[model samples]
Structure formats: C-alpha cells, structure tokens
Target chain A: MSEITPEEHTQDTRPAKHSGERYFGWTSHPKAGLYTFIFVGVLAVGLALADFFVHRHEYIHLAEFKIFYALFGFAAFGGVVLSGWPLRKLLGRPENYYEPEEETDNG
Target chain B: MGDTLMSLLSHTNPGFIVILAGMLAYVIRGEIPRAVVTIGGPLLGLAALVLHSALSEPLATLNMMDMTFVLYQVERVSIVFGLAFLIAATVNSIFALHNKDPLQDSMALIYAGAAIAATFAGDLITVFVFWELTAVSSVFLILKSGTPEAYKASMRYLGIQILSGVLLLMGATFIMGEYGTLEFDAFISEGEGLSLQDDPGAIFLFVALGIKAAFPLLHNWLQDSYSKATHTGAVVLSAFTTKLAVYALWRFFPGEDSLIWIGAIMTVFPVFFAVIENDLRKVLAYSLNNQVGFMVCAIGIGTPLALNGAAAHAFAHIIYKGLLFMSMGAVMYRVGTTKATELGGLYRTMPFTAIFCIIGAASISAFPLFSGFVAKSLTMSAVGYEHMTIIWMMLLFASAGVLEHSGIKIPFFAFFAHDSGKRPKEAPFNMLLAMGIASFFCIWIGFPFLGGTEFLYGLLPYRDEAMVYLEQSLWTTDHVLTQMQLLVFAALAFIVLNRVKLYPPEKRGVVLDFDWVYRRPLYHALVWTGAVWSKAGPAMTGAALRLSRRVYNRIEATFSPQGELSRGPLSAGMAIWTSIVLAIVMVLALIVGPH
Candidate 1:
C-alpha cells in the first residue's frame, strides 16, 4: 500500500464537504440553536402561565397545583437525559462486542 | 354470477386473499405484475372486510378433526385492528415498491396476512396456526439484511417467536381440557375476557402474549431483530406483530391486574436505554415498546373507555409507527445506516423525508391536533377515572420520556443535529408516497372537525363511551392545555439540557439490554461447559471403565470355577448347611407365594 501523505491523511479524516442542494440551510446557522431554545422557553413559560388563568380541572389531586405537569415534564425529561451518563457507562459496549466471536467462527 | 362472487368474497378471510397474492407474487417475475399483486392483495382484503354482512358472526368456518374452526369472524374491535392492518399493508407495499427482492415481497405479504388471520380468528387453534406462520414468515425480513448479525438475530427472533407459539398451543390445550372448547365466544362473554385467576390456561396465554408484546424482560428480541432487518423489512415489521399481540390480549385477558404495572415498567425502563442508544432504529424500537405499554395498561383497566383507547391507539400507532419506520427506512435507503453518529445534515438533501419524519415525531409525542393525543386521551382519562394515581404519574413521566427519545431525538439527531457533512439523495418516490399517506392519516385522525376522529371513534368497541369522550373530555380546554404543557415543557427541558451540555452525545457502540444475559453470560457459560466436557468427559469415562473392570475381575476371581470354587471338594458339613438354607428358602417361598 502506498503511504498516504500528511495532507491527504488530514483531508481523509476531515468531515466531507456537503455537495447536495441545501434544503434547510437555516438550520446550520450558528444562532439556530439559540433561536430554538428561546422559542421553546417562551412556549413553555406561556403554557405554564396559561395554566394559572385557565380553571384547570384534573382527576388527580396533585395535578391541581400550578404547573405540576410542567414541573413533572421538565424533571422527567432532565432526569432521563442526565441518567444517560451513568447508564451508558453501565451498559455501553464496543460496537463489535456481540459480533467478534461470530466473525471469528465464520472465518 | 356477480351476486355469487360477492357472497364468496364476503365469506373469504381477507388474510387468505393476501396470502394468495403473496404466493402469486413469488412466481411473477415482472416488476409491474408483482407490484400489482402485492399492492392489489391488501386492497382486495380491505374490500372483503368492508363487504362482510354481519358483525360478531362467523362468515366462514371449517370443520376438521371433530372441531369447527371459525376462520373469518369480525368483531368491532377486530374490524378496527383489521382495518388498520390492511391500511398498513397497502402503505407498506407502496413503501417497498422500489425493492426488487421477490422473497422479501412475498414473505412480507404472507406475514401481514398471518397477522390479519390471527386477528379475525374466532378460535385459539386458528390463532395459533397463524401465529406460528407469522413468526416463520417474518424471519425472512431480518434474514434479508444479508449480514451475519442479521442472520443470527433472525434465528433468535424465530426461536423466541416459536417459543411463544408453543406456549400458546399449550395454553390452548389446557383450555380445551378445562373448557372443552377453544372458541373465544365460548369463554369470553360480552364485556369480559377469561379471568386469569379463574382459568389455569390464562397464565400460559398471558406469558405467550407478553413475549410477543415485548413485555419488559422479554423485550430484547424486538430491538435485536428490528434494528437488523432490511430497511423496508423494518417498516413492514413495525406494523403488525406487537399490535397483533395487543389485540389478542384485549380479546383474551382484558382487566388483568398484573398488566398495569408491567406496562408501566415497560413504558419507563425503555426510556433510559433509548436515551443512550446510538442506533436510531433501535431507539424507535424502544419507543414502540413504550407506546405499546400504554395499550397494555389500558387493557388492564378494562373500562369501556379504556378498551376504546387501546383499540384507537393501536390503530393510530400502527399508522404513525410505520410512518416513523418508513422515514428511517428512507434514511437507511440513502445513507446505508441509521446510527445517529453518522447521520446529520440529511435534511439539507432530504427535506420531504425530514418533514414526514417530523410529522411522525409530533404524532408520537402526542402533540395536540395529532393522532397520539386523541388516542392517548382515553387511556389517561380511564386511569384517572379508576383513581390509579401512581399509574397515571408513571404514564405521565413515560410520556415525557417518549418525547425525549422518539419525538425529539429521532428527528433532531437524524435530520437536524450537528452536520456530519455527508450528503445523501432523497428517498425514492414510492417511499415518499407511502409516508405522505401515513402523514395524512396522522393529521386526519387527529385534527378536529375533520371527521377522521369521528370515524375512528365510531369503530370503537364501546362507541358511545368513545363518542362521549370525544364530545366532552377530548377537546376540553384543560385537557389540551395540560397535554401541551407536558410536551412543550419536555421539549424545553431537552433544550435546556442540551444547552448545559448534559445531553449525552451519540456514540458508536451497542447498549447492553436484557439480551446480554443470554448473548454474553449464558452463552459463555454454555461454551465453557462444552469445553470442560470435551476435555474431562473421556477421562472420567475411562476411570469409570477401569473401576468397573476391576470390580468385575474381583467378582470373577471369587466366582471362577476352575480357579477357586472347583479347587476344593464339597464337604458334608457344607452340604448340610446348604440343604438347611434351601429348605428354609422353600418354606418361605411356599408361604409367601401362596399368600
């Protein structure tokens, strides 16, 4: 095999340039994430505020509290996301973990 | 002649027509003809279902082995499921039109047909036959992936599925023994199913359905096989199997007390695994498990509204879940893999697919004016009515979890996350058409005043309860607002977590699940045992032979005539003693034998 030059190797390892037509180019803008966060934050605050004005009837007693669903939703989602750190450590394995032996046997 | 044909068509089990189409598709080499047969089959099946003259009566029956098998029977619940399945089949055929593999095409229709057959089956034996057929036929979808891993996964899937079928047969045997009939109508009366406490067979049936339903510990086969199936195969596979199990459970074991907690756990635990999962398809599989959990829990509640929720949710879920799979399948079609780490910036090229994927995501997240909201409302309300506060809380948490994995992660990572800078082509026209149809249903069945919701509600087992919910509780201001709060806040949480850099990055690896118990430890234990036995087995056998030979020699040495016994002559005292012993033995034998 021919030795790959330093420049060629670097190029090979670098992410490829996107060559297709850009359908949602705005998504790639630097401020897109900031915009999305702001939009969702506003929506969440609006919904929580609306809960106070609306005479909300609920079957469960605890849900009658202001923003209970909102708090629960936030905590549940955050808890699940944060738990991923430890869960990955506990359960994650190499991509080839299950297949190495089968490959060897087949070979 | 036309009247006769109509009568015959109405009498036909729609599944048989689809199976015939599958058989026809196999030999027809031309693409157009094969597509015609494949797509036309489900259409015909739908027609057959619609033309049936009466409900809850056997349209077709077969007598064999001194028993009658109701091959084609339609209940309201069956109609809803069967309708959804037929719709799924048609859409799936369209989605797979670009694929040229006859084996996959034929097997898919057969699998779909078997599921439909089992759905409409009025007897347990009939259900068992089609149940095994579904397992046998659908394994080809996974094998079609043409990878060693896929092959192995397919084998595991088949083994587990066949085990389920075997358990079902055992339960049927027990039912026959106890009830003297396998007919569902004989045991399950109006508004009630077989009680697990009263019936010994119900437990076996429960476990069997549990395995198929992907109940928590028994769930790995779904993720294992589904993620390995061919792209089109996954879309087809998503539509039928678990939903069929849900239907069976609703038919046989509604009001099961254990199912509520089982379903609650199912909904919760997959959230963690899915959060860390890198394979996008497997994430969808976990999401599927969570969604099915809602149906299972509702079935446990067994209220009219709850049952309606289960049926409506199954119908909507089949469409939306299949749509999601189709979207991912489209991604897989162009990108060759659905690993989150490798997929991004895809929306730049695949805008239509991205839009469809978003629709599927929104539908699954139970966003207002989507199918999930309408379908899930009944279940949530039913649990609330029953005063199951803990169960309701768990379901609420799981709903947020669903948003994290399926609603946001799926679309966000695949289409809009950090660009991997890889550009891929848009999906084929057929795939887009299928997704478009599914997306339309998601909106149609969800949007108010569209008549889709009304039509779906009309098909519920308890139509009055469903209609009442639709009119009063479903669209009430508080209900919609609370649901919106849950989803919007969950999404806000996602954004906040991402901003804080707490969201886990997609990594290239496998997440161990319950399958690890079998795939790693149990597998290694068997291997270790085999290796030990290979070495120690012969040595132990040789030792055993040596000891036995020594014992035989000792006995021979004492008994041999020429060596010891013949070396000495008999004495008079020995002869007298022998005679006395003989006389005593004769006396004992005479007394005992006569008595």
Candidate 2:
C-alpha cells in the first residue's frame, strides 16, 4: 500500500523497510546469520536425537541405522545442489541457448 | 419444497454450474460483477457437490447415442477429486481476481469445470468429452499472455493436449470394441477397480494420461506453456490439467506395476531440471511433475493404503501447487518477470507472497506437519510394507530433491537471495487472500491436531483401509521422527552448501528438455526440408522437363504420323511388307478354311 516507487527506495542492499522488517529484521544483520545457522543446527540435532528415543519400524534396512534419515537427507540434498554445477556445465547454453537472437530483442 | 430441491439437485451436474458461471461471466462487463460470478461459480459448484455427496450412485444419466452417460456420479473417488477441483477453482479465481480479462476468467472457469466434470464422469464417452473440453478451454490461459512466445507455447500446449484427448478417445474406442461398452465401469475385475493388464487400449490410455501428467520425456509442454502464460493465467493453469491426469490415472491404472518405475523416474529427473531452471514458474512446473510422480507410484503400488495416499496427495497437491504458482504469478505480476537470475530481495517489498511461497514449499517438501506429510506417508509406508526396496530408495532420493528445488530453492532465490535491487509492490489484496486461504489449508491438512488428516482420510475411496492404516501408522512416534529427520537434514544441507558457496547460481538460459526435440530440432528440420526443396525444386523440374522432351522426340520418331510413318519412305516400305504378309496369310486362311 506504500506509494514508494522503485526509484525512491534506498539503494541499500540490506533490508528494505516494510512489515517484513518486523519479522525478518535479523536476516539483514550480519551477526544474526550465525544465530540462524545455530538454530538450524540445533533443530537438526534435536531431530536426530529423536532417532535414539523413537524406534522406527522401517521398510529399508539402511533406515534402521542411527540418524539414517538425517544423514540421507543431508547427503541427498547436498548431492542435488552440488550436482547443479556439473549439470549447468553440460546443459547451460548462453541466455539465448534456445532462441539465441531473441534475448537481445527482448532485453 | 425440500423434496423438490433434493430432486432438482439430483439431476444437476455440479460441474455444469461452474461452467455456466463462466459462460455468464463472458456477458458481464463490470469488474465487480465478473469477479462475483467468477468466485461465486465455484462456490455454487462446491455447494452443489455438497448437496449431491450423499448420493453414491450416478445421480443422473443421459441417454446419448444409444449409450448411458453418467453425468453426475458422487462416489468416494469422484467426490475427492471433485471437492479438490472445486476448492482449487475457488482459490484460483481469487488469485486471478485482479485481472479484468473476461477471456481469462471464462477460460479458467471452463478449464476447472471440465476437470471437475471429467472427474464425476462414470463412462469413457463422458470422460472423453470433458477431457477435450479441458484441453480446448485451458489453452487460452497461455494465449491470453498476448506474447508471441506465449502464443506459440499455447499452440504447442494445445497440440499435446488435443493429442492426449485423441489418444484417450482411441483407447476408449478400443475398449468399447473389445468389451462391448464404453462405460468406465468396464475395467472393474470382480472387486479391484480398473486394473490395466496387457490390454492394448489401456496402454494408449496410460500414454494419454502420461502426456498430461508430463511423464518424463513427455513433460516439456508443462514447463514451456506454463512459464510463458500471463501471470494470472499461470496460476489458473497450474491447478487443473496435470492433476486431472493424475485423477484419471488413479481411476484407470491403479496397481499397474509399470507405473512404479515410471513414477520413480518422474520424481528424480525433474528435480535436476528444476534446480537449473531459470523461470520460477517453470521450476514449480517441474516440481509439480515431481510431486505427481509420488502419487503415480502410490497408484502403482495399488494397495488400499497406497491408493488412499494417492487420492489424498492429489487433493492436497492441487492446493499447494496452485499456491506456489500464485506466489510466482504475483511476483511476475508486480515485477514483470519470475526469472530467478533477475529476481532477488523481493521479500523486502512482497513479504506476504514470500511467506505464502514458503508455506507452499514446505507443504510440497513434505515437512513433518504440513499437508504433504499426512498424504505422502500413506504411500511411503505402503511401499515399505510391500518390501519394494529399490523403489523406496528412489522415492527417498526424490523426497530430498523436492526439498532442494521446490522447498528451498524457490524461496531462497526469488525472495531472499543476493539483492537484485528490484523493488516491486506487494501483491494485490485479492491475490493475498487467495494465497492466504491456500496456505492455511497447506498447514491445516497435515497438522495431526487440526483433524484435517481424519477429514481427508474419511473421503478416501477405500475409507476403511485408510482408517485402519491411519489408526496403526499415521502419527506413530517413529514416523514423525523419521520425517522430521529427513526434512531438517535436507534444510541443513542447503544451509551448509550456501555457506560454502557451492550452490549453483541462477543464470538466464533455456535448459534443453524433451521439447527441444520438437521445438528446436524437429522444427528446424522441417524448415531445412522446406529450404532444400525450395533450392532444388526448379532444377529438378527443369531436368524432368528435358527428360520428357527427349522421350517425346523418341516417341515422335517411332510412332508419330508426320515424324516417321506419314513422312518417311520407310513407312512406304513397311506398308508394302505388311500387304505382302497379309496377302500370304489370307491365302493360307482360305486353304485352311476349305480343309
């Protein structure tokens, strides 16, 4: 609802003032980044702890290992993200890879 | 009055009300009136569905072409899909409320209506009619973008959709020919519903649904068309077409073993494409394909619990996927693009959209308390119970992949990544309302405390089986712990990768998909053929002319009156020889006749 234009907004790459600032104020703060990391790490570990407390009747044999899901989740996600590098190398064409000349026209 | 109302409702096709509202919307000019009709149509259709839900049998049948067409079947399977379709229609209408285009509004309604209609269809002929209607009506969503690219993409989308419809009809024909009926009921074997064995017709039907479902290589149409659609059009487009195919597959090919491998491939490949995809809408399209794979695999498992899982997942998926698309649509509406390479720091200006997108992402990623967890658990457990070790592993891999592409990448890149310095307005109030509603359901359905799991379970076709599984397995400490472990660790992986700067940066480019075969090489090949023909045509024509002239000259020399027989002395000698031969023959004939 604010009447501010893109031009009028401050050029600071940090947080732009909005209601989002009310909730996500710390995201822009460099020191708070560590807190965010810690929060996630603690949550991941706590869930892993549940592995010891909760006995899972799993279908896959590998799933019975301690924190198996945790390790698998971490590895699978990392693999997908890291695989992007190679995939891009193989599949990445210039911006106009599909329609080479059209990008310039649109741009 | 009550009796009369009940009787009237019995004959009414719930889907027709929505379609009629669409038709009515075309005639209205005012934004408020059109919005009312657009939103109200689905609401009324939802009401019709509620009114008709008590009737388990076909509420009414049409005698057309000497065959009975069930216009309104309100069985458990149809009810689940029907309800989901109605909810999606209502939500999408709200998302698209800001757009004043009557064409987009009407087409969206018609598209949704056709899907709902097809859902309630008890016979193949009825399914075919609505199936093609969905194809024809939905293309305008892409076309309404009014871009040349969108126009071309719409044509491609339309072509594939119509091809699916054609194949479906062909399958129906074969089924009818073999079974002496086109009723969808023909496939039920003693008690198992619609099992596809070695039937040739079922294979055709499977391929048709696969095309719509974007089964791996057949998936290019979804990304191509959806990414190019008008902002609202994309939101509306996301809800119906592919999910309809999923419903159809659930109906027809449940328990077919081939679906297991096909579904596994579906879940894995899209994750990679989505990772590298530049268009946010296109990424969601890939994510949609991946999610459908889970449902498909469950259907392949064909157990009661798995089938219930597929149905529940479809119901939930329609809402979440639509929400994700709406969020991206809002971004495109405000900023004129959803390319991740060009978008960042949008949460500064578009906080609500960002939040909704995250909710959608979490739901799709199967966060422990989201809608996906409740729905997907049934399938995963069914897989485990069946001892399909390898397929289960592939599904596990896909689970992590979903978190990577749809769950994390979407929000991280578009809203919170490196600031691209693009400040856009928050989405309109109507779009926010739609997203808000969808996000609420995303959380509501999966939270065990919210009773959504029970409500959704009650709607399953195999209700007793689902409830038994629910009682035994749904909220076990082990299941919840494992799910949380899987999802949280995936999040941990993303954070670590981001900290290490190992995540691939989004860039502008078209990654080649199967569409490249048709859109690029096949098109270019045709163009090349045309060019070759153009270049070589005249020379070949001239050579043919020269050869004909030589043949004409030879013919003239050999048989033409003026060229040889009439003008040359050889003709006179030949005539004299012919006369001598004839005279001798005549003499021999006279002697023989006398003898």
lDDT to native, each model: 0.92, 0.86
- Candidate 2 lDDT, B1-595, residue by residue in tens: 9888766765677788899988988889999999999999999888778778455567778897778888877767778888999999999998888888898899889989999988887788899999999999989988988887887788889999999999999988889888888766666531154446668788789899999998889998989999999898888778888888888888787888888888989999998888888888999989988999998899888888888888999999999998999999999999999999899888888899999999999999888789988888888988998989899989999999999989988898889878888888899999999999999999989887788888999999889988888899888888888888888899888888888888888888878777777766787787788779899988999999999999999999878776666666878988899999999999999989865
Model 1: how far residue A87 lies from native, Å: 1.1
In model 1, the runs with Cα more than 4 Å from the true position are: A1-23, A105-107, B541-595
Q: In model 1, what is the error at residue B42, expressed in angstroms?
A: 0.4
Best TM-score among the predictions, by candidate number: 1
Q: Give the TM-score of candidate 2.
A: 0.89
lDDT of 1 at A62: 79
Error of 2 at A102 (Å): 8.9
Per residue, candidate 1 scores C-alpha lDDT tens digits across A27-101 of: 788898899999988989999999989998788987989999899999999999999999999999999998987
Model 1's lDDT to the true fold?
0.92
TM-score of each: 0.91, 0.89
Give residue B150's lDDT in candidate 1 (0 to 100). Answer: 97
